[model samples]
Target: MLPAIIASSRIVFADDALDIVQGDRIQAEIDALRMEIDDLRDERDEASLDATRRTEIRRLITDVVADAEMRTNRIDRPWNVIASADGDFTLEADVIMQYDWVLNSTSSEPTRYGFSLDTLWLSLGGTMFGPKWSYGVCAAVGSDGTFIPEYAYVQHQFEDGLFVQAGILSEYFSIEQAINPNEQLGTSLSFVAGQFDAGQPEGILVGRQFDQWRFWSTLSNGWGQSYIDPLENQRTGVMTRVELKPFGDWNTLYMFNPYPGLVDRGLLFGFGGSFDWGDYAAGTGRSISGDATRATADVSWQQDGVGLMAAAYYQDVPVSQTDGGRRWAAVAQGAFFPVSTWDVYARGEWGAVENGSRSDFAMATIGTSWIPAGDSRLKVVFELVRSWGSTADWSVDGDIGILSTDGDQTVFRTQLQFAF
Candidate 1:
């Protein structure tokens, strides 16, 4: 009986000790779970604060960038500017019209009384990232309703003063070519330029400016072609020109739309030449491959309400046989500005074709123009022209002619021009 009582007491004591141990284990697990929950809450709070700081920093950075751009870069707009902005960009246009009345006609074109659109041009250009880079484009509407692209080019000017240009650009090849109709002593370019000088070429131009001189050279495809084309319009050409300002910037020259205003002063002397090599198509069932060469020289001076200019040209065209035969042309011109708005001028031209026949033209011209500003001009020009020498004449309109039926021509031409 004593052994049974002792065993029962020991069993009860073991059960109570096991219960206490289980209770302590359960409390420890609860405390560990509570600590994990507290750590999670702390991490969530820190993540929210970090996110807020990042968003504020982004807003501040955006504001700063916007302010900097506003201070440095801006677009310009102006009234009366077509194609480009007048403030930072450039806009250009030229429109011309003329009336010709033929008193007598010897050859095919009998309908003489008419009105003609001489030129219709619109242009846009601008410099970007400062004056070191530039781009421009010009378009023309021909009388025959053809749309032509003119000056579509880009240019980069280096720090050392060298400039590179590519595409279609217009810079006169000679003094005669440099003179626009309104600025010319005559109503049109000399016959030498008309017969041989290609109007404009598409290619690359390299130029440099010195203190008292400027020089440029071009490698390009001739009229009616593009440099990107290597097959059909196989004509490749090169032209180079040099100008000397003996009187300093007083004689600074602009290659296009040159205006040697007597109001300002200086002397400008220039020389230039060009040659074209290609497979040429003259007439039906014929093709000639050879070189066509040309040379021109000119000088101009202006001071104290007086201006004078003279120019000459020479050219050689290969015969259809690609061997012996050749053609040539020459011209001389001068102009005097007597008053602020009045001018007098004269030009003489001579040309020969493959047959060795020579012809010539002489003209006297008078002009009066109004200058509203530096880039805007209006002019009225009158010219009396006489044809002489050989009956085979080259006219300014790119026509080889016999000065009318009797091999003599007397013409009175009047023209009006506006440019801005």
Candidate 2:
């Protein structure tokens, strides 16, 4: 009778394990396991099996169930490659690929269309000695096929709830800048963000999270400088950002648009400032010498399928005693999922520069995105942008790819993105 019970338990274990491994429904597998366990418990007949035999059978069943659950978790998150049995150490890999097509209304600028692997990010990140110590390394290829080192940082979590990160760290000055390009609401970042982008630089960052609020400060060679730039020409500055999350968790707050059936609601308010002193070499022999101060404020809110974000930026750079000066910009954007697989969004921007000419400008953008029901990893976006007012030269501000032009300018963009 004991041998018969053992055989029955083996059959149950084998069938359940196979189902869990092959099926994508985690909750269904869990329910099946529960039903099987209840059936085994009912087989506790005193005449058929002794108490010791029943106890052994239960132990085997528990062990097999645990193994099956672990496998299910691995299948659910394939990117999280476990490095240690205790789960204190882990490794994760991520990739982002974007292909874009653009048509500019300006006669001087030819329509640009092609697969510009603008963000070929191949990154690995994980914990080291323990869960408190972590590191990340990213290598990327730019649109022009240039090898760019993105982020290489090591961070440590102190016992006192404070954290410090050092190395070539990414920017945290603006919420727009912090978001990945592939996740941006528009085809590209706004003109304001492009002008004031605090590019990745070698720096040391310190921060702490208390309840729903957190702040981070980074001291580094200032904005527009990457890790591979010339050290002698670097602009030095310190950037600080603070955030208050009045509602949901951080994960659901960062994305510009909510996924299908997103139930986690969130509200976030953030402010950041930076001051840089020194000369920034603009070109071959042209350089701007002075001190620059910048400040930005932003707010984000999301509930279910609706999302909204607004940000404002101000910068003052007194070069020499004249000739150059200040700039301010503001943007308000919103998105809503009218259908389960479709997202519609719109954005408005206004900006002005204090330089002599008519540098005031405004841009309006409307876009739509589609994500198939079968796969959320792939996204298709189409956006139309229209701008007016006198423009400054694209060289003066890193305008991403769009060229500055006189009169009203219109651009149509289509993008296909995939990530894992």
| Local accuracy by lDDT, each model | 0.60, 0.76
Candidate 1 positional error at 400, Å: 13
Across 161-199, the per-residue lDDT of candidate 2 in tens digits comes to: 999999988788889988765567756677667766777
User: Residue by residue across 258-289, what tens digits does model 1's lDDT show?
Assistant: 34352456788889888778764544354546
lDDT at 331, model 2: 91
TM-score of each: 0.67, 0.75
Predicted structure with the largest TM-score when compared to the true one: 2
lDDT of 1 at 285: 53
**Each candidate: RMSD to true structure?**
9.4, 20.7
